[model samples]
Target: MDPVPLLQALIRCPSVTPADAGALSVLEAALQPLGFACTRLRFGPEGEEVENLFARRGTGSPHLCFAGHTDVVPPGDLASWTADPFAAEIRDGLVMGRGATDMKGGIAAWIAAIASLPRDLPGSLSLLITGDEEGPSVDGTVKVLSWMAENGQIPDVCVVGEPTSRAVLGDTIKIGRRGSLNAAITLHGVQGHAAYPQRADNPVHRLVRVLHRLTAQPLDSGSEWFEPSTLQVTSVDVGNPATNVIPGTARAKLNIRFNDLHSSTSLIALLRAALDAEEARYELDTVCSGESFLTSPGPFVDALVAATRAEAGVTPKLDTGGGTSDARFITRYCPVAELGAVGATMHKADESTPVEELRALARLYAGVIRRLTAG
Candidate 1:
C-alpha cells in the first residue's frame, strides 16, 4: 500500500483529458481489495459518456467522502518533456508525468492511507473519482453529486484532493476558490479609409474606452479567506493586416477572478452598464466557469488546522486564492475543502512530486480522517 508505487502506476496511464484509458479500472483494482464497495457512473450527452466512480464502506452517519479525479490534461509540445508524459519515469527523487503533481498523486496517496486503516474502523469511507475534470466538466462531479443525492448517499463533509498545497507540503489548505467568468465583446463601427477620420466610427476607441472603465475600478479589496477580485483582459484582436484601412469590427476577451463580493449575473450587469454608459453598438457573451464559495474558518476548518499542526508541525494557512475547480458544485451539496501535496509542478513540463512527500501526504490524509471521524 505504499503510495509511491501507486502514484507511479497512476501516472503511467495515458488518461488524457476526457479519455479514461483504464485509469478508473486501475483505481478500482486497488480499492476492491480494500473491502470497499465500488460503483461506476457515467453521465453526459447521449453519445459522450464521462467516467465517474463512487465507492463506500460501512453504513454510518458522519460519512466522510474523499473526492478527486483521475484525468490528466494533454501534454503540449512533447519535445519539452525530459520523459514521456505518460511514461511515469522516476528520476532523482520524483516521478514525472502530466497529473503527477496536479492530482493523481494526491488521489493515490489517500487510497494508500485508507488501505493502512482498519476496515472495521469507525464511521464510513467513500471515494468519488471522476475522469471529466480536465474537460468541459458538464458530465463530471456535478452529475455524480446529483446521482448521489437521488440515491441517498451524500456525505456530511467532503475533502477534495486537488493539488492545494503551496511552497511546502501541508503548508496550506484551500477553503474556497475565486469565481471565474469569461467574456467576449464585439464592437461595431463604420469601415473607411484611414485618411477619413470623421467618416468612420472607430470601434476600437469605443472598445478601449469600455475596457478602461472596467479596469479603472478595483473589483474589491478582497475577502477574509479570499483575495481581492480582479478582471484581466486576455485578448484583443481585429485580425486586420492592413495598416491604412480602419477595421469595421473590434473584439476583445476578458476573464474575471471574483470573490463573494459578486456573482456572475451581477458582474454581467456591471459590464453591460459600463458599455451602455458609452452608448456603443456592441454584442457580449459571458460564460461562467464557476461561482465563488467559502466554508469559513469554523469547526471544520479549525479541525483541519489543528490536525496539520499536530501532524506536520506547522500551522497551515487557510487560503482561497486559486482559480475554479469541481469544488464549486460540491459546495451546494455539503461543506468541502481542498488539501493535498505541494503543487510546484502542476500542469508544467516535466511535472513531478517527491517520492517521500507522496508518502507523507498519505500520512496526513490518515490524520485528517482520524480527526474528522472521531465524533
Candidate 2:
C-alpha cells in the first residue's frame, strides 16, 4: 500500500485528459484487494467518452468521500522533457511525469492512506474519480454525482485532492474557489477598400471600445473569503491579411475569474449592456465553468486544519484563491475543501514531486481520515 509504487504505476499510464489508458484499471486492481466495491461509469456522447469510477468500503452515515481526477493535461513538446513524460522516472529524489503533482500523485497518496485504515472502522468511505477534469468536463464528476444522487450515495463531506498548496505540503487548504466565465465576442461590420473610409464601418473600433468598458473597472474590491474578481482579454483577431481592406468582422475572447459578488448570469447581463451601449451589431457567447462557492469555517474545516498542524507542523491557510477546480461542482452537493502537494510544477514540462513529500502527503491524508472518523 505504499504510495510510491502506486504513484509510479499510475504515472506510467498515458491517460492524458479524456483518455483512460488503463489508469482506472490500475486503481481498481489496487482497491479490489482491499475490500472496496468498485463501479466503472462511462458517460458522455459516443465520440467523447469519459470514464469515471465510484468505489466504497462501507455503507453507513458520516460518509467521507475523497474526490479527484486520474487525468493529466497533455505533455507539451515531449522533446523538452528530461525523461519520458509517462515513464514515472525516479531520480534526484523526485518522481517526474505529467501528473506527478497536478493530480494522479494526490490520488495515489489518498488510496494509500485508505489502505492503512481498518476495513470495518468507518461509517462509509468512497472515492469519486473522473478522467475528464482536464478535458471539456461535460462527462466527468458532474455526471457521476448525478448518478450518485439517483442511487442515494451522497457523502456527508468531501475532500478534493487538487494541488492547492503553494510552497509546502499542507500549507494551504482551499476553502473555496472563484468561479470562471469565458466569453467570445464577434462584431459584424461592412468590408470596404481603404480608400472608401466613409463606406466601411470599422468594427475594430467598436470592439476596442467594448473591451475598454469591460476592463476599465474592477469587478469587486474583495470578498470576505475570496479575492477580487478579474477579467483578461485573451485574444483579439480581425483575420485581415490585406493592408488595403477593412475587415468585415472582429472577434475577441475574454476570461473572468469572479468572486461571490457576481454570478455568471449577472456578468453576462453586464456584458450585454456594454455591447448595447456601443451600438454595434454583435454576437456574444459565454460559457460558465463554475459559480463561486465557499464552505464557511466550521467543524469540517477545523478538523482539516488540526490534522495539518499535527502532521505537517504548519498552520494551514484557509484560502479561496486559485483557478476553478472540480470542488466547484462538488460544492452544490456537500461542503468541500482542497488540500494536496505543492503545485509549483504542475502543468510544466518536467512536472514532478519529491518522493519524501509524497510520503508526507500520504501521512497527512491518513491523519485527516483519522480525525474525521474517530468516534
Candidate 3:
C-alpha cells in the first residue's frame, strides 16, 4: 500500500502515449489481489491502438469511480534532469520522474488508498484508467465511457486524479474546466504588384480587419464559477517574401479558452459573423477540444470538499479553471471533480512530487471514498 514503490514501479515503465509498456499489467496485478474485476480495453484503429482499463469491485448504489491517465508526455531534453526521467528515484524525499506529478503518481496513490480500505465496502468502487489522454485522445476515456454505458458500468460519481492542487496538496479541486477552440482562417485575394494603384486586393488587410473585429470585444464579463472568455491570435501567416508584391492569400490561426457563458458553436458563429461582415472570400475551420462544463455544488461535490479538508487540512477551492482533462468526457455521465497533489512540477523538466505529498494524496482519496460512500 506504499505509493512510493508503486509510483517508482510505474515510472520505470516508460508508458508514453499509445504504448502500455506493461504499465497496465502492473496495475492489473495490484488490483486483482484486491478482488477487482479488471477488464483490458483496446481501442482505436489497428496499429495505433490505445489501452484502457475499467476495474470495479461490487455492484451497488453510489458507485464511485476514480478516473486517471497512465500515459505521460514525452520527456524533453533529458540532459536537463539530474537523473533518468524514468528512474522514479526517491531523492531527498521526492519521487522524481516524468509523470510523478502529471499523473502516474496519482494513479499509484489511488490504488494504494484502496488497499488500505476494507475488503467489503458498502458500494462499488471502480477505476477508469486510459492511456490515450496525452495523445490524440480519440480512443481514450470517451470510448471507455461509451462501453461502460452500454455495459451498465457507469459510476454514480467520478473523481479524476489529475494534479489540480496549486500551492499545496488538496488546496484546489477542479469542479469544471473551460472549453478550447482552435480556428484556422484563410483569406484569398488577387495577387498583383505593390506599386499598382487599384489592380489587386490585399488579403492581409482584409484578414487584419476580421481579426480586429473578433478581438475587439470580450466574449463576456465572466460567468459565475468561471472566468471571462478570451480570444488570442496564435499565428498570422503571409508567405510572401517580396515586399514589392501583394500576397495572394493570408492565413491566421486563433485559440479561444472560453467559459460556460459560451460554447464552441456560439463562438464559431461569432467568428463567422465577423468574417461575413468583411464581405471577403475566406475559409474557416475549427476544432473544439472540449465544451465548458460545471459540476454544480451538491452532495457529491460537498463530499470531496469535506474529505480534502479533513485529510489534507486545507479547505479546497472549488475551481473551474485550467485546460481540459478526460473529466470533460466523464461529465456527460455523472458529476465529476478533480483532486490530487500540487501540480507545480507537472509537464516540466525534472518533474516530481514529495513522497509525503503522494502518501497524503492517498489518504485524501481514502477519505473521499469513505465520505462518498458513507451514505
Clashes of each: 0, 0, 0
Global Cα RMSD, each model: 1.4, 1.4, 0.8
What is the Å distance of residue 8 in model 1 from its true position?
A: 1.7
Clashing pairs in 2: none
TM-scores, each model vs. reference: 0.96, 0.96, 0.99
Q: Which tens-of-lDDT digit does each residue in 217-309 have in candidate 1? A: 898898777789999999999888999888899999999999999999999999998889878789999999899999877878887888778
Provide the overall lDDT of each model, using Cα atoms, as 2-decimal numbers: 0.89, 0.93, 0.93
User: Which of candidates 1 and 3 is the stronger one according to TM-score?
Assistant: 3
lDDT of 2: 0.93
Tell me which residue pairs clash in candidate 1: none
In model 3, the runs with Cα more than 4 Å from the true position are none
Question: For candidate 2, lDDT tens digit of each residue in 1-375?
Answer: 789999999999999988999999999999999888999999988877899999998888789999999999999998899989999999999999999998988999999998887776658889999999998888999999999999999998999999889998899999999999999999998889889979999899889999999999998899899889999999999999999998999999999999999999999999999899888899999999999999999999999999999999999999999788999989999999999999999999999999999999999999999887763
TM-score of model 2 vs. true structure: 0.96
TM-score of 1: 0.96
